[model samples]
Target: MSFEILFLVIYFVAMAGIGVWAMKRGKQDAEGFLLGGRSLGPGVTALRLQSSSMSGYMFIGAGSMGYTQGYFSMWYALGDLGGGILNLSVLGRRMRKLSQILGSITSIEYLEHRYPSKWIRLIAAPVALFCMFFYVLAQFIAGGRGLEMVSGVSFPVALAIAIGVIVLYTFLGGYLAVAYTDFVQAIIMVVGMVWILVATLMAVGGFTKGNEAVGEINPNLLTMWGADLGYQGQWGVILGALLVFSIGYMGWPHVVVSHMAMKKPSVARTAGVYSLIFNLLFIPGPYLVGMFALILLPNLANPETAIFEVADAVLPTFAVGIVMAAIMAAIMSTADALLLQAGTIASQDIYARFINRKMNDAQMVWVSRITVLALAIIGYAIAAFDPPAVAAVVIFSTTVLGSAFVPSYICAVWWKKANAVGAISSMIAGTLVSVLWQVSGAPDATGIDPMVTGILASTAAMIIGSLASQKSHPVPEHIGRALDETAKIGPIPKKMLIDQDALLASQAEMAGRHE
Candidate 1:
């Protein structure tokens, strides 16, 4: 076998080995399977969360945007750098404490506890699951494209192989396998991308020469504005890009779920610092490679393949295999997490909580695994038949999820007056406005990104709804007490705490009395 094939074989075997190891050693209970027993240390938590947040979009879509739009595309990275910090600072510690206090293993479950409304859980679960399915489909498309490019296999066969591997590991090992593999994959991604960037820069005679060469073709390629030199450089467009990734982190289920799984609230501080450093190193390299591709493969037909094309042209066969594996790592890391989130929502939130409240730990575990497999197949099928533009799919899914959850998520932890009515209205309004904006071509017409509209609308709805319903839908006293206790900085005191068991028992008592 060629060195590339050999490297891939080793890579695939290593991933499967991790899965088997996790299955044997990792926790098998529902909480352990889904949330890693809330025992993840700072380093693992940081790497896993950062890796899961970034998909192939960082390498493929971001690179392509750089190649097509030039320096203007860097705005996305600028936004993301601050976004990681914001997510950790604002939601990380608080959410971790609240989820544990409320005994919420999933984001939807967290919302249910925070709002204490069946309608909120029902609405949030399906919406999150649907958006996450599309996000997984985008990753499948990215994997298929990478596999096809590197192996010269047909797209369908490549897609099948990609999905098969992801499903096997994720199905068998669950969250533990996903987190550990993500830690490994995160290293590979940074090292590989940095390698490709350095080699390409050296080959093209460094940044100065590369820019000159690109300038010769079109000077606009080096400008803050894109080649269009018009609306693309507008402030609204840039602001939208910045806000989407930066503030949007709060709403992402797969990303924010990491907060709920950490070993301690303090882990958020350590993980935040580490994740910020990782983002700084990882986000810029691909976009730089995209710009470098301008000189290296100027005539390349598809800009999105800039990173792959550059790597294949410059790296040795064995090194090429490693780079390809890194790309696979990027794609699969996020895919596994997304699939896991979808499964957790379906089985834990929808099935166990709503449909069959009597499910034991073992039964829930099996249901979760089966749900993971089913969702993977569905995502794979969508990718196999007719995949939309990967960038468009990613942005849409991210925007929808961000719009639906950001306002409510932030308010649940911070705003004492935020009731179920406010949270539900914000979610519905955000989703609806975002979809309508996209369908109406408002972004194209007005040069404002849909995310901006969605976020603004959602925020407005939250404030307005909460104020309007203050008299009719008062915040529950227990919830207010829990929030007050959790808002403190230090570790929660055992004496002052209302543990999950007590809370559940009290809720049951209230239900019995009402009935």
Candidate 2:
């Protein structure tokens, strides 16, 4: 008990230390603070990107899934192992190049710049905030529940403690702080996962023995059909599980911000390699740990805490502290990024774009900090009053965010015909379909995941809407040029990346100019 408490205290101090270090580095200007002056090293960028997207999903949700559904949970892990690198390889360079061309500091700003639509920012910003808020709430729930169990405190107090620590550090440091701290937390998570997995394998007499034991308990646990063959013929469910993490990262505003924060467009390639290596090492450990626990600790009350319980059973008291701290660290790392991106979009995308366009650096920072506080309050209220399972909230939020923006984001640099009408149509249709599909319980009924349906709806909207409205809403000349540059093979000349016209183009009229 004392060890867990001590490690928790130590972890908080370390995060604060990183925050203070970031503050002292003197990148307090709005641009520097928001995007780390677009100067992240490849390693930091890779890990921060992965860590932000990985979140409590891996620590809590993935384990819970493995423990409950058995081998089917590996489908998510397989997709996740490549999601980060896939995102970087496809969008990293293009987004970095395009965002710099348009002077976009936020992902919402990047969309508006690419599609040349004020409505895109107006619509996308709110949807992003709405989705990301739920995401942060999931992290809060995961952390709060963990703390509650470890500290024997009331849920409200434990939640307050978790959110309080995360909020304090976030308030102190800006983007760099979030990135560096996630980088550090990613390292801790990898080490702890590897340590715990090895311990589990040893305890169960090896992977083969462990699986045999699980099969003896329930033969279905060893199959890809999920425990009891519940999803025996549900290919749609299986596909959704795979696609959720794979392509979802490309569309998430919070995760994609890492692209815009790269030091240069060329950093994307190196970052991709780093991402894949990290993913390969860390992505499957939690699920495997959870699956093996079907034999070792078969009676856990909450499957979400499978890793924690397994650690407590297998590891020494000190190692148990480190292991739980790693899970909490993952929760906090992801929460920090979500808060930073949500705050960035709220202050820069919505506020500056519409409400107060002339704010200075200090004012932007102040507004952002306040916005972070507001989001934390909103998330706390939602989570404290009616918290759902971490996995459910994460999947719904991921589906909405991914569906709402995936097609538009991909088309921003890739499709020359992508215009304002199409982007707006895509965003609205995607979000509407995603929400309706989930609410209607279509996934269980029809076996089609909201993510698949949402992406399909959004992509079709982007294609059909842009084509139908081409004469009235052709892509702006400057944005087309930006897209051309982004599509090129190698490092683009700096002069070509950012031009005055691209920077100052009026969002209201850029797409409508040709008409």
Candidate 3:
């Protein structure tokens, strides 16, 4: 085998080995399988969150944007960089505290507990699954294309191999495996990205020369408004580009589950700091490399392949293998997370909650695994035959998911009166508005993006829906108490905000106090 192929084999073997080890550690309990028993440390949590959040979108989609749109793509990167910090700071600590207090293993379960509604899971679960499927589909595309390039295999064979590896690791180890593997992948992603950036810069004689070359080809490519000045004076599109990734990820169910998997509530503070550091190192590299590729490989037919093509073009034989692994790392890290979350919802929220209420922990674990396998098959089929634009799929799904859930998720911990009606209404309205806005091409006509309009409609729906129904559907007393304790961060005696390490006495004390 060539060094590239050999290196890829070694990388795949290592990932599967980690899955086996993690399986032994995590065991088969529902909590262990689904949430890693909430034992992730700050560093692990931070990198895992970032790795899963960036996904193939950063590797393929972001590069494509930069290759085509030039410096304008930087707006999305800025939003993405800020989004990580914002997610950790805004939802991190409180979400960790509240989800545990409510005994939620899944993000959807947390919504049901906080809002106190069966309908919440019934409706929310499907919406989440639908949105996440699109996200995972993007991964499948990126992975297949990456594998096809590296292995020189047909697309079908490459896609199956890629999917198989992701599913195996996720199937064996569950959340613990995914988290640790994500940490490893996050390091690889940044290193590979920086490697390509350095090589590209050297080839082009540095950033200044690269820009000058791009300018000579077309001065518009050097402009922040995008090639041909496509977005000039379109401040609405500009704001949307910045806001979409920055605030949008806060609403992603797959991403926020990292908050629930944290070892403790206080970990969020350190995780936020870690995120800031990682973002600065990694976020801008892909876009910068993509723009540089415009000068180097101007005739590149597939813009999404800019980074991969750059690595292949610039790196030596062994180093090329390393970059290929990094691209796979980007794809697999997020693919596993999406698979796990979708499976968790399918099994815990729908199968157990609705189909078989009395199932035990072991049964739940099996159901989750089975659900994951089923999803992989369906996702593979869709990806193989009718692939949509990876970037478009990611943006559309994330926009809708963020719009649908951001208001409800933020309100869950922060607002006392955020009733089920409000959450449900917000989810429905946000999804509809975002979809309609995208489908109807209202964003094109109005010069505003779907994210801005969808979030606005959803936020309004939440406030109006909750206030109008306060008398009819007040926040349950139990959840209200949990929210209060979650909010009351200071003055708690012992191991900080209602610690998990403490004995059952504290829990009972709160129960008695409530009664």
Candidate 4:
């Protein structure tokens, strides 16, 4: 077998080994299987979060974009960094706390609880399912493309191998296995990226030579500015991407699931900071590799394959094999997480809540595992058949979450007047506006991001709806209790720790206080 084929086989075996090992460790119950028994520490959480966030897009698409667009692609890293910083400082703690308060092991549950809207929950269920499935589809597609690129195999053959490896580990081991494996993959990704960058740079005689090479071909490609970039090449695009990406962190079911696995709010808080540190490496990797490719190989048949072409040109056979494995690792790390989140939401939110809430923990665990396989198969089929607009797919999902939930979440955290009517109105309006904006081709026409438009409209709906329904219902005391539990800084006050019994007791105490 060629080195590439050999590496592919080894990568598949190693991923399967992780699944088998995690299963042997007895992650049998729902909590154990789904959230790693709620025991992930700062380091594990940080690495897992970073790897999952980068997904296939950072490894493949961003690299391609960087190579094609030059320094314009670096703006993506800056945007992600800004988002990470804001999420840690502003939204991270609140989300962790609210997840606990609502007993929300899933993003759908969190949205439902925050809004107290049945319609919101109902609508969000299918949206989460579709959104995550599509996200997973992208991963599968990228994995297939990456494999086919390196190995010169048929796309279907490569996709099947990639999908099989991911499904075997994810279905058997669940989130615990995924997180641990993601950490391993994260290290591999960092090493692979740095190794390739260094080798590529040395071959080109450093940044100065690299820039001259690119400038000799196309002068604009050597600089931060570009012809088609418009405001996108400017600081506004950077800041907008950062702001949009950062605010949407709470919306991604996979990322939010990481927070739910934390044993305590403090753990999530610490992990938030740690997440940023690891992300520093991943966020910049594409820029370095992409920019380097631009400088080295100024012309290509397809810009998206720039990384692979560069690897083929500069790296030895053995090194190319390693980098190919690293790319596969990135795709698997992300695909498993996406698959897990989709399965969890499908089982917990849709199946368990509406279909059958009485599912035992063991039964639920089995269902979730089954859902993992089902979702992965769906992802694979889509990957095999469908081609999508990659950036649009990501932005569409983010916009769905942002417009539908951000207003309600913000109000739930900060505004006492936010009620169910407001929450429901915001979601319906937000989702519609976003969908319409996307369908209307507004993003292409006005150069305004669809997310910004939908969010603005949704925010207005939430505020107006809340004010109009002010007399309907006041903020529940449980929301305040949830907030206190999340913040984890106040005294172990009476309002916190609100189980069913504690809720009754708090109500009685409040009644007495009124008397």
**Relative to the true structure, how large is the alpha-carbon lDDT of every model?**
0.77, 0.78, 0.80, 0.67
In terms of lDDT, the poorest run of 10 residues in model 3 is 497-506
RMSD of each: 5.9, 5.6, 4.4, 5.5
What tens digits encode model 4's per-residue C-alpha lDDT throughout 1-515?
67877986776667667666666675477775555524767777677657666777776677776776677666556667777775544354455456555666566677677667677678777766776776777777777777778767887887887778778757554433543466676677777777787788887888788777767766666555552446443443444355456665555665443333333444544666677777776677666676677666767656656777777778998888888877777777777767777767777787788888897778777877888778777766666765563444665676677677777777766676777888888877878887798789876676666677777877899899988987775667777665555444334443332211221222343464447
State the lDDT of candidate 3 residue by residue for 1-515, as single tens digits.
Answer: 67888998887777667666766665467765555524667777677667766789888998898899988999888888878667545355567667767876677877888898899999899998888888888998898888887777887888888888778757654433544466777778777888888999999999899999988888887778989897999888888788788778777875554333434555555566677888898888899888888888999988988988988888888888988888877787788778877877887899988999998889888887887788789888887866677788998888998899889888998999999999999999999999999999898798898999999999999999999999999998988878887785445454343233222323644785668
lDDT of 2 by residue, 1-515 (tens): 57788887876677667666767665477775555524667777677666656788787888888898888888888877657656545365566557666776667877877887789888998999899888888999899878877787888888888899779757654433644456676677777888899999999999999999989988998899888798888888877788777777567875454333333454545566677887887787888888988888899888988887888889998887787778877887788878887877888888888998997788788887898888888778878866788999988888888888889888887889989999999999999999999999988889888988998999999999999999999888988877765665355565443221222223323454435
Estimate TM-scores for all models. Answer: 0.85, 0.86, 0.86, 0.83
Q: Candidate 2: what lDDT?
A: 0.78
lDDT of 3 at 398: 85
lDDT of 2 at 73: 88
Decide which is better by lDDT, 1 or 4. 1
Which should have the higher TM-score, number 2 or number 4?
2
**Residue lDDT tens for model 1, 190-245:** 77888998999998999899888878878887887886676445787787777777
Q: lDDT-based ranking, best first?
A: 3, 2, 1, 4
Clashing pairs in 1: 83-246
lDDT winner among the candidates?
A: 3
Give the least accurate 10-residue stretch of model 1, judged by summed lDDT: 496-505
